[model samples]
Structure formats: structure tokens, C-alpha cells
Target: MASFHLVSLGCAKNLVDSELMLGSLLAADHRLVDTPAQADILIINTCGFIQPAVEEAIEEILALVAVKNEFPEKKIAVVGCLVQRYRDDLVAELPEVDLFVGTEGTAGFADLLAKMIRGENPGRLVLPERSLMDSTLPRVLTTPPFRAWLKITEGCDNHCSYCMIPSIRGPLRSRPVNDLLQEAVRLAAGGVKELSLIAQDSSAYGRDLAGADLPTLLQALLAETDIPWLRLLYLYPSGITPLLLELIAGNRRIVPYLDIPMQHVSDPVLAAMNRHYRRRELESLIAVSRQVLPDVALRTTFLVGFPGEDEEQFLAIEDFMRQHRLDHVGVFAYANEEGCAAQGLAGQVPAEEAIRRRDHLLNVQAELAAARQRQYLGRTLEVLVEGVSAETDLLLEGRSRYQAPDVDGCVYINDGTANPGDLVQVRITDSQVYDLVGEIVPDVGLAKEKNTARG
Candidate 1:
């Protein structure tokens, strides 16, 4: 049995795919290693959505190549978007890599690599992908046992001009409701308290199916699973229907948080980027969300410095951000990727200018997030304890429903005796720009916590 060290790069969706790869290899009797030097094979699941991500992937491969040199017999495998996107280019550019797996990562990888390693010599590249994912496939949960990402759908139908996901990952394919339910049940059984549903287009889940949609699937998941908190991520603004908002408001199991990826709101820029929604529509969306889901922590991402985005257009985006004061916000500089529609468009923003806009907006969001965090002070909320703090073992760190794992900040518990994965009441003592300072209070029941939070 060959020992392998797999490095998974990019988003949470990619991480799930990495887990699937790991599961496939392990099921085939391959052992996993913690580091490159300890392994006979090194696998890299890379992201190539944009040029920068590709550069990052290349850097990782070069680092691994150095390690591979130490043991001349050790094999290197480069997989995922980088290979899917620039397979021909990568094969020529990176002869050091032996195996190349694409986005359609399936059980084929396990068998193919096993044979190739035994037969092959110094260095080369090889591979293809097929099959949809389901509950039947064994996955080693890479995240903490308390929290896991449940990717509901694969690929993207919305082909934004500046984005390459549709080309790299392909079109939408939602998992069956029964299949998802089975997975949820398995996760709950394995002690996962928080399961966040993720996808390229989450709100559009089950659109391909005749009878199933997001709400229907959500009801089933809530009714069936013992998991306490289920959060939604990467929902397009228009897809946040009134019925969906109502369901989230009424059910405590469905955490009061929404992750809307509104790339831009300016009409001209939105049109150029091929986004369907308008400024007025987004305003209405926020207004309705605030009215219906009062406790909801709204999060969104904005792409600044698109090809046609001028100073006036960018100001509109900044103005909208300042007006909304969203709970969480992420800003990204537009990537002028090759083959994207925007690459041929006129009036491209300069790199320094784009970075300037990104940094400025991030600073604005930081101030807004700091102000928004104050509301939690002197209130009670349920926190999923995540063991000792990274900063200090003297303190414990956990996440509230408002805070999504990794992307959002944590609640640092200064005085608390709770194990990891334990769901307990935390009284908000203080707050930061993004993080929170709290103490565990066993006495504050769920009902009391809700009432206290409302006050």
C-alpha cells in the first residue's frame, strides 16, 4: 500500500471533492500521510478559477517537486480545476507531475494511480473524470467533527463574464433529496452539530429535478436530521424567495444567516458581468429580508474593478455597501482571466487600482462589522465550542450561528469548561470588529436565549 499526502486548495466545494478523492484512495487500501517526505505519492487538488489561483497551484507543485526529489521513486499527482482548465498547457509546463485528475473527480483516480505508480518510471502526467457524487461514496470528514460542509449541488449554470467556474466545473447537477437526507443522517450520526449547505448556486438547488426545490429539500433535512444548525451559502439574491425567508424565520434549526454573492449592483456593470439582478431589486431583497428575518445576519461578496467598472460605477457599489452595513462582507478584485468575455472587453481597470478599491471596501466592511457586532453584547446565544483557541490554550474558541466556520470570526470563551463540539449557551460580554468575547452560561436555556437576544 502506497502512502500519499494530498493537498487540497481553493473553496469549500473543492475541499469536498478532495475528501471524495481521499475516500476513494483509502477504500482502495492506500494509506494517508501527514507530510510529503513521509509519503510515497503526493496528490495536489488545485484551483484554477483565475490566473492568480493557477499561480498559487504552480507554487504548491514546485514546493512538492522539491520534496519529491528527496525520494526519486516518489510520484506526484496534480488534480482538479488546474488540470481541467489547462490540461494541455499543464502537461507541457509541469512534466514533474505524474498523474492529472480533472474536476469530475471519481473513483477512477484510485485504480488509475495504483497501476500507473507500479508501471511508470521517472516523470509524466495522465487522466479523465466521470460520475456524480452521492451518499454511498465513503468520505473522510476533513473538517472538525462538530461542523461539516454539505455541498448540495455540483457546477454552475450562471456563466458570469469574469468567472471560469462554468467552464472548469461544468453545469448544474443537484443531488436527489433522498440521497442528501441519507448523507445528513450519516453526518448527524457521526456527531456533526453544524452542517452548512454549500454549492455554486445554492438557492437554485433542485431546479433540474421535476418535483424538488430548495425549500422542499430543507424541510426534509430539518425534519429528518438531529443536526442542530444548518446554514445556507452562495445563494443568488433573486433566488431568496419570500417562502424561503419565512421558513428560515420560523425554524430555529435553520440558522438565521444568508450568504448572497451579489457580484455587483450597478446596472451597467451588472449587465456587463451578465448578472441578472438590478440595484432596485437588491434594495428590495434587503428590505424584505430585514422585515421578515429580523435576527438574520446577512453576508455578501462584491467583485470590484470589472472591465467596464469606472469610478462612478465603483462608487455606486461602495455607496450600497455603506448604506446596507451588512453583518459580513467580502470584497474581491476582478480577475481579467483568459477566455472570459470580460477579457476582450474595453476599459479594463488597472491592477493597482483594483487592489486599491478592494482594500478600501474591505476597510469599510471592517468598520461596519465592528458596529454590527455590538448588538450581541449583553445577550445570550448558542455557540458550538471548537476547543482551545489558536491564540492561546488559556482561552476556548467557538462559533455562534451568526458566524460561519473559517470565513467568519469566532467567539473566544475566557471562562468556560466545554469540550469541542459541545453546543452551549454563551453570554456576549464584549465584541470585536469581527470576533466576539463571551462566557459559557449553562443556565440560559434556548427559549431564554432567544428572548434575551431579541431584547
Candidate 2:
């Protein structure tokens, strides 16, 4: 069996694709290695959503190429979003690569590589196909055993002015409800405790299909799967119906967390960005969510420094942030991609000015996040242990419902004996700008019983 090393760089959605590709390789008797130098084949699954990601992909490809130069026999395969976006066009730039696969035909990658290794020279193979997923497809999980990501849809329909998703990923294509349910059953049977549903626009799931919708799918998963925690990511604002919120509120299995990507809060900015909802609609959504689920963690992302974004529009976002005091906030500066509509828009924000705006919003969020965490102090929130702390082995870290893996803060279990994936109650002791310090409550029933005595 040929040994291979795969490096996946991108969002969790991209990671799923990498997993799919790995499954194909493994099925074809290709062994996966831990390091690029230790393998006969090196695979780089790259992200090309924006300019920064494209640059990162290029850096990774060049770095791998440098490694390949030392071992002339070692072959490098560059695949995923970057290759898909540009197709065979990357042939001129990175001629050192042995293979170039795109977003589609992931399952057929092994056959192509076999042909090339025999000197057939498969060249650049960016076919018009898909590796979105299949219920029966064999996949090797790259994430922690207890957690997995379920991509419910492929591509995107929302042609946001500043986004390259629709162009690169194509139109929205929701997976059949039965297909997702079967996949979820497999994940649950395989010991996955937390399953995060992901898509370019998660709330838009089933709109392009027959008989399936977000709430209906959630109800089925709740009834069928044993996965303890179900979370949704990348929910567009307008599609977040009250029915969806109510279903989430009614189910303890569906953790009280929502990742609503409200790019901006100014009417003109929203219109320009092609976001369907206006500022008032966003306010109404938040209001209804607060009323329906008081303890829900509302996580949102903001894009600062869009074209024609003046001080007034920027200040409006700051004002909205102050008023909402959202549980979690991610701020990003807009990128002017080659084909994006915003690239041609008048009154472009300077690169330095964009960075400044991004920094300003981050500072605001830091203060707000710190304050929001303080509210959790003394409260015993359920946390999923995520193994040893990256900072120190003396500590264990986990995440509460409020904190999504990687993107948000974590709860540091200072004095606890728990395995990864164990759901334990933790009493918060301290709060930072992003993280929280806590002690595992050790059997929530026991902890609650002793709360008065401990006090």
C-alpha cells in the first residue's frame, strides 16, 4: 500500500470534503501517514474562499514543493476549493505538482493517482461532479471521536456582493432529509456525542428540495439519533423562522446555541451586501429569540469595511453590538475578490482602514464577551470535556453550549477528573475576554445537592 499524508486547511465544511477524499484513498489500499516527509504521497486540501485563503493555499503548496525537492520520488497532490475555483488554470503556476483534483470527483481520486503513478500522467483532473457525501460512503473521522460535522447542503444560492461562495461552490443544493438522517444514525452509532450541521447557508436547507426543511430534519434527528448535542452553524438571518427557534427551544438535545451570520447592521450596507434582511428584521429576530429562549447563546459574525462603508454605517454596527451584547461575536474585514460585485463598487475602503475597522470591532467584542462571561459566573453550566488544555497538561479544557469548538472560548477544568466527551457540569470561577475558568461539578446531581453545603 502507498503511504500518504493529507493536510486539510479550511473550515469544518472543507474538512468534511477532506475526510471524504481520505475515505476514497483508504478504500483503495492507500495508507495515510502523519507527516508529509514520512509519506510517498502528499495531499494538500486547500481553501480558496477569499484572497487570504488563496494566499495561504499558495504558501502551503510552495512549502510542500520545497519538501518534495529533497525527495524526488515523493509526489504532491493539490486539491479542494483552490483547485476547483481555478480548475486546470493552476497548471501554469504550480507545475511541480503531480496531481491537481478539484471539489468534485473526490471518490475517483485514487484511480487518477494510480494512473499517474504508472506514468500515464493524469494531468489536471477537475471534473464536473460531487463529493458532497453519501450515506454508504466510508469515511475516516479526523475530528475528536465524540464530535463530527454534518454538511447538510452543498454550494450556495445567496449571491452576497462580497462573497465568492456562490461563484466557487455553485448554487444551493440541500441533501435529502433521509440521507442526512441515515448519516446521523451512523455517526451516533460510531460514538459521536456532538454533531454540528453545517452549510454555506444552513437555514436555507431544503428550500431547493422536495419535502425537507430544517425544523423537520431536526425533529427526525432528535427522535432517531443518540447524539447528545446538535448544533447549527452559518444560519442566514432571514431564513431563521420562529418555528425553527421554537423547535430548538423545546429540545434539550439541541443545544441552545445559534450561529447567525448578520454581516452588518446598517440598511445601506445590508442592501449593498445583498443580505436579504434589514436592520429592524435582525432586531426582531434577536428579540424573538430572547423571548423564546432566554438562555440561548447567540453567536454572530460581522463584516467591517465593505465598499462605501462610511463612519456612520460603521458606527451603526457598533451601536447594534452595544445594544445586543451578543453572546459571541466574530469580526472580519471584507476582501475584494476578482469576480465579486463589491470589487467594482465605488468608494473602496483602504486596506489599512479596513484593518483598523476590523480591529475596532474586535476590541468592542472583547469587552462585550468578557462582560457576557461574567454572567455565567457561579452558574453550573454543562460542558463537554475536550481533553488536555493546549496551554498546560495540568489543566483540562471543554466547551459549554455558548462556545463552539475552535471559534469561541472554552471552560478550563482546573480541578476535575473527566474523559473527553464527558458532559459535566462546571461552576464558573473566573472569566477572561474569551475563556472561562471553572471546576467540574462531578455528577451534576451530586453537585447540586452539595451546593448549599459548599456555599
Candidate 3:
């Protein structure tokens, strides 16, 4: 059996695709390796979402090429969005790569590699058109055993002027509700306690699937399984319906957290970006969410310097964030992607200006995050242990229901000795900008504690 190593870069969606590819290869009796140097085949699942991401992908490919030079017999392959976007150009520029596969062609990776091994050229394998084949493919889970990302939909329909997702990923296509449930059940059965529902636009889920919506799907998941936490990620602001809020408020399993990517708050910027919501409408939605779920963790992403975004617009976004005091915030400097509508628009901000705007917004968010975290001080919270801290090996690292993995901060448990998957109560002792320091709560019941204190 040939040994291979796959390096996945970008969002959870790309990670899911890589997992599916890995599973297919493993099923075909291929051995998996940790590094490119140790493998006979190297596959890179790349991202071409933005300029920085594209540059990172190219750097990775070049590093692999250096490895290939050292061991001329080993082969290298590139797959995913980068390949889909720049097929012929990549092939021409990076001749060291032996195989090139696109996003739609990833499902046939094993067969493609087999052909390459047999001396077939297998040139560029970009699909002529997008196909929604919900492969019941196996996956070699790369995440911690306790948590796994369940991709409910593939591709995106929204053609945001600043985004390249639609052109690179094609139209929105959701997996059937039954298929998603089966996958969730399988993951849960395999010891996954937390399942984060992920997609390009999770709120737009089931728009393609007749008689299905996100809330309905959530209800089905709650009724069908017993996963400890069902967190929703990548929900759009415009789709945050009253029904959805009510379902979240009532459902015990669904985490009271939403990752809504509100790109910008200014009406002009929103219109230029092709987003449907304006400043007032977004404020109304936030007010409604706060009214319904008082403690809901609102995580959002904002684009700081899009084409035609002025100083006033930037300040408006900053003011909006300050007013909301969001639980989590991600600020991105806009990049002019080729073929995007914003590419041809006038009034492109200088790179320095973009950086300044991004930094200023981030500073605001840091202060807000610290203040929000302070509110939890001395309170006991349920935390899922994810790993042991490297800085202080005795301390355990984990996240509360309010924090998502990787993107959000984690809580540090200083007192308790717990396993990776154990859910334990921890008393918050201190708070930082993006993390919490806590001590594990003792097992002594509240009544016992009062009696002991009295004695």
C-alpha cells in the first residue's frame, strides 16, 4: 500500500473535504503518514478564498516542491479551491506537481492517484460543471474525539461582491436532512459529544432541499440524537428568524451561541457588498436576539476596507461593535479578488489604510472581549476538556459552551484533573482578553457545602 500525507488549509468546510478524501484513500488500503518527507504521495487541500490564503497555499506548494527535489521519486498533488480557480496556470507554474485535482474532482482522488501510479498523465481533473453528489464517503476524523464539524451544505449561492466563494465553489447545495442526521448519529455513536454544524451559509441551508429549513433541521437533530452540544456556525444575519430564536431558546442541546458573519454595518457598504441588510435592520435583529436569549454569545466577522468604504463607514462599524459588545469578533482587510464585482469598483483603499482600519477595529474588539469575559468571573461554568496546556503542563485547556474551538478562546482549568472528553464544572477565577483562567469546582454538593460550613 502506498503511503500518503494530506495537509488541509482553510475553513472547516475544506477540512471536511480533506477528511472525506483521506477516508477514501484509507479505504483503498493506502497508508497515511504525518509529514511530506515520510510519504510516497503528498496531497495538499488548499484554499483560494483571499489573497493571503492564496499566497499561503502557494508557499505550501513550494515547500513541498523542495521536499520533492530532495526525494525525486515521491509525487505531489494539489487539490481544492486553488486548483479549481487556477488549473492551467498552476500546472504551468508548478511543474513539480505530478497531479492537479479541483474541488469537484476531490471525490475521485484515490482513483486518480491509482492512475498516476500506472503511468497515466491524468492531466487536469476539473469537473466541467458542479455536481451535488452527497457521497456517503468515509472520513478519517482529524479533530479531537469529543468534537466534530458536520457540513450540512456544500457550495454557496450568495455572490457577495467581495467574496470568491461562489465562483470557486459553485452554487449552494445541501445534503438531505436524513443524510445529515445519519452522519450526525454516526459521529455521535463514534464518541463525538459536540457537533458544530458548518457550511458556507448555514442559514441558507435547505433552501435547495424542498420542505427543509435550519430550525426544522435543528428540531430533527434534537429529537433524533443525544449529542451533548449542537453548535451552529456561519449563520447569516438576515436569516436569523424569530422561529429560530425561539427554537434555540427552548432547545437544551443547542448552544446559545451564533456565528453570524455581518460583513459591514454601514448601509452604503452593505449595499456595495451586495448584502441585503442595512444598519437599522441589523440593530433590530441584535435587539431581538438579546430580548429572546439574554446570554447568547454573538460572534461576528467584519470587513474593514472594502472598495468604496470610507472613513465614516469604518467608524460606523466600530460604533456598532462597541454598542453591541459582541462576545467574539473577527476583522478582515478586504482584498480585490479577480472576477469579483468589487474588483472593478472605484475608491479602493490603500493597503496601509486597510491595515490601519483592521488594527483599530481589532483593538476595539479586544477591549470588548475583555469586558465581556470579566462578567463571568467567579461564576461556575461547564467546560469540555480538549487538551493539556503546554505552558503549564499541569493545567488543562478546554472551552465552555459559549466558546467555539480554534476561533474562540478557551478556559484554563488549574485545579481539576480530567480526561480529554470529560465535561466538568469550573469556577472562573480570572479573565483575559481572549481566555479565562478557572479552577475546577469540587464534587461536594451545594447542600453538603452549606452543612459543612455550618458545622
Cα lDDT computed for each candidate against the true fold = 0.88, 0.87, 0.88
Estimated TM-score per prediction? 0.96, 0.96, 0.96
lDDT by residue (tens digit), candidate 2, 1-455: 68999999999988988888898889989998898899999999999988899999999999999999999899989888898787657888787888888777565678887887778977565555653667777778999999999999999989999988887778888888898999999999988988999999999999988888999999999888867789999999999999988888777778889999999999999999999999999999999998888888999999998999999999898999999999899999987998888999998999889889989999998998899989998988888899999999999999988889979999998997899988888999999989999998757473343212211
- By summed lDDT, the worst window of 10 consecutive residues in model 2 runs over 446-455
Clash numbers, per candidate: 0, 0, 0
Off by over 4 Å in 2: 445-455
Clashing pairs in 2: none
lDDT (tens digit, per residue) of candidate 3 on 166-222 = 989988999898888988888888888789999999999999989999998998888
- For candidate 1, lDDT tens digit of each residue in 270-315? 9999999999999999999999888889999999999979998888
For candidate 1, report its TM-score: 0.96
